[model samples]
Target: MKRRDLVIAALIVGGLVLASAVAVARLAGDPVGLLTRDAAASAGLPPYTGVISTFTVMVWFAAGTLSAFIAWTDGKHRRRLAPFAYLLLALAADDALLLHESVGPRLGIHELLIYAVYGLGALRIAYLMLGEERIVALAFWTGAALLAISVLVDVAFLGAYLLEDGAKLLGVLVWSTVPLLAHSAPRAAVPVLGLDRALEHRSQPG
Candidate 1:
């Protein structure tokens, strides 16, 4: 990475640590808790209990990172991939924090409302992918379909935790393939300004 990129990354990490300390202090009056214990220990639960959720969060984060990398490196496709980067990152944060299920409820924001917002975000992504390669778009659509089904099962099947979570996990896995597919697909030729003029000059019996 460039020195500037490294510096920016360091600043971001530092800011995150500072913000987290402040938040912890405000909420629990003990910033030490943020550093001293793992989440499972703090919750009095076995570490394995959160394994699946942790995996899901990791996948979401990985997808976001991949999308961001593509956006940064491929100027031609940056506009299309940038939104995916942001949305995937937001999803990762929401999942990691249980924002929709727990925090949103406490804040009087209905879980359904949060789901609707996410649904619209997914639709926006689908629309953006309309001009992409068919295979890549198809994978994303399949992932979205699986996620929709997971949401449906969550609302209707109530107690079918295994099925709902399984579908959701599969959806995330499929969705995460989009960045990889995009990165591997042949890039279109980028137009170079004045190239034609230069070629014409060279061709003119020089």
Candidate 2:
């Protein structure tokens, strides 16, 4: 990954966070009484009683977009395809989120797939980052722990979807990892043109 790639990753994660904030806000400010009940039908759990204002939605959505971007772009460090694929997968869920308010359970499958991919991608990134010996510090350890916890949180959502409606709100926990992932390891530089090694090294910048 190049420095520019890292910057882009940060931007993507920021976008996810932003998106999530917007989602929660809309749920709260459902002008026409869309959210008749604060409780999630699948999870059987109540929604947050706190005011879900547009400002909250804006902030959460931005963060969600940012995190979703990071999870989607999972392989920028080595294999670009991995990240690109994940981003596309996340989009399915993002779109599902847009219509879930009116669709009523029809889009749960899409949302579920998104959460699964997001969790797995997050786990992969944490594995890579934690492999670095230098990441044994307090901050790094905290981040890694959070990533691990996110996997469980995602799993909880899966369980809720499959069994009860009590845990549908689990996504918030996993998406929170976006900010942590934004602080990434130093990326490898994209070497300039070097004809001598062009044929020998495929990854070398042409």
The prediction achieving the highest TM-score against the true structure is 1
lDDT of 2 by residue, 71-138 (tens): 46543433322342344334334433543323434745564554566557755544433323243222
Looking at model 1, residue 138 earns an lDDT score of: 81
**Clashes found in each candidate (C-alpha, N, C closer than 3 A):** 0, 36
lDDT on C-alpha atoms for all candidate structures: 0.81, 0.43
Q: How far is candidate 1 from the true structure (C-alpha RMSD, Å)?
A: 8.0
For candidate 1, the 10 contiguous residues with the lowest summed lDDT are: 189-198
Q: Which segments of candidate 2 are over 4 A away from where they belong?
A: 1-48, 52-105, 108-112, 127-206
TM-score against truth, every candidate: 0.81, 0.31
Q: Please, what are the lDDT tens digits per residue for candidate 1 over residues 1-206?
A: 78799899989999898788778777887766665467988888887986877898899999999999898998645656789889889989998888998999999999999999999998887876765666677888898999899889988899898888888889889989988887777755221332323433443584
Assess the local accuracy of residue 62 in candidate 2 as a C-alpha lDDT between 0 and 100.
53
